[model samples]
Target: MELLDFARGPAMEWAFAIFIIGVLWRLFGIFFLHHRRDLNEPRHGGAAPWWGAVKTVFSRMWPRREFRERNTYSTVLGYVSHIGLAIVVFGGAFHLLFIRDLFGVSWPALPTAFVYLSGVVALVAFIALLVRRITHPVLRLLSNFDDYFSWFVAVAPLVTGLMAVAHLGARYETLLAIHILSFQLLLVWFPFGKLMHAFLFVPARAVTGYVFTRRGAAT
Candidate 1:
């Protein structure tokens, strides 16, 4: 099959299926595998658990004292890259049309030039983070195969996407196919890797907040 057909047809379908199934399986395993209950007495508590959880989740959006002092640059890079990539992927006019066709919903999209610029910024930030991971002793020590592999999978789409947009190194059809294929690979890798944190962090933060609130610590 042609690259375009394979990417848009079977490959895209496979990626979506694996993404949905893998996410569901991983989530189920997290909730069901952990059955231990905390039996320790609470130190003090006035706030509702739900309220504490909600508060903690939103409060963490602002950097903590330690993050600001110790890793402010890294934190800023993370925010910039993540937010920029999200805009490029979900706020682009082309992407909005695709979303509308697939899901029967539509929304305003950012201008194409802005979307392109955001994608470039996101790619640059991602590369910077990878360089930091490689150069920093502590981060390098903590890093493993999954970290690098996830980085590759995550960045491949951005690189190919830029190539597609610029019509560079190949025909546009081929570049678009490669871009879609890279995204599909990312979806397939998401569930088993640190990428799962995107989905897992919400509940994890909520539980952490609930526990902290029960212990009378400020969230």
Candidate 2:
């Protein structure tokens, strides 16, 4: 009937479907495209020992040692944005409600104040990332169309979510509609864009670390 009604109905369904399917597609693509490269072969090294690979990923985010050696402001911003967004997505009350409505699943939600704080953190981190991308020369040089598009696509939901909470501009329903629409766009673009890195990054990092460790380049 009305746009608000649609947002709470078909739009929600479509957004959830696209998100699930898109994530699956991206994971599948990464799994199929990358042959298991060996990490210890004499030339290229055989594959890293499985346990070692796991350890590498779990330890890769440490601020000291090799992780910090490679770090830059852009990396810091990216990490902060990802962490904040994960907190908001997994901890927010509205997200829990949406899950209950769509999937008949429920989880404990963060406190209302925490939900608002998480949203603000996610939004601030996202804006910092955007500014970093524009100002950082190396990042700018490395960025392609997909990189720029992915930033906006990922950030749009957070911005609209804040607006939705404040009931700014249009009603909450309209803000929510905009949020869901942006999320759908992100889902559709994910598999074909740099955003697929979300699915691939862990494995990729593991393989790199393993290769270097076996070669005595990383310790």
Error of 1 at 171 (Å): 0.7
Give the per-residue lDDT digits (tens) of candidate 1, residues 100-166.
9889999999989999999999999999999999999999999999999999999899899988999
Clashing residue pairs in candidate 1 are none
Candidate that would win on lDDT: 1
Model 1, runs deviating above 4 Å:
none
Give the C-alpha miss distance for residue 161 in model 1, angstroms: 0.6
Compose the digit string of candidate 2's lDDT tens values, residues 57-123.
Answer: 8876666564576565656777777887877787888888877876798889877787777778777
| Positional deviation of residue 155's Cα in model 1 after best superposition, in angstroms | 1.0
Q: Among these predicted structures, which one has the highest TM-score?
A: 1
Q: How many backbone clashes does candidate 1 have?
A: 0
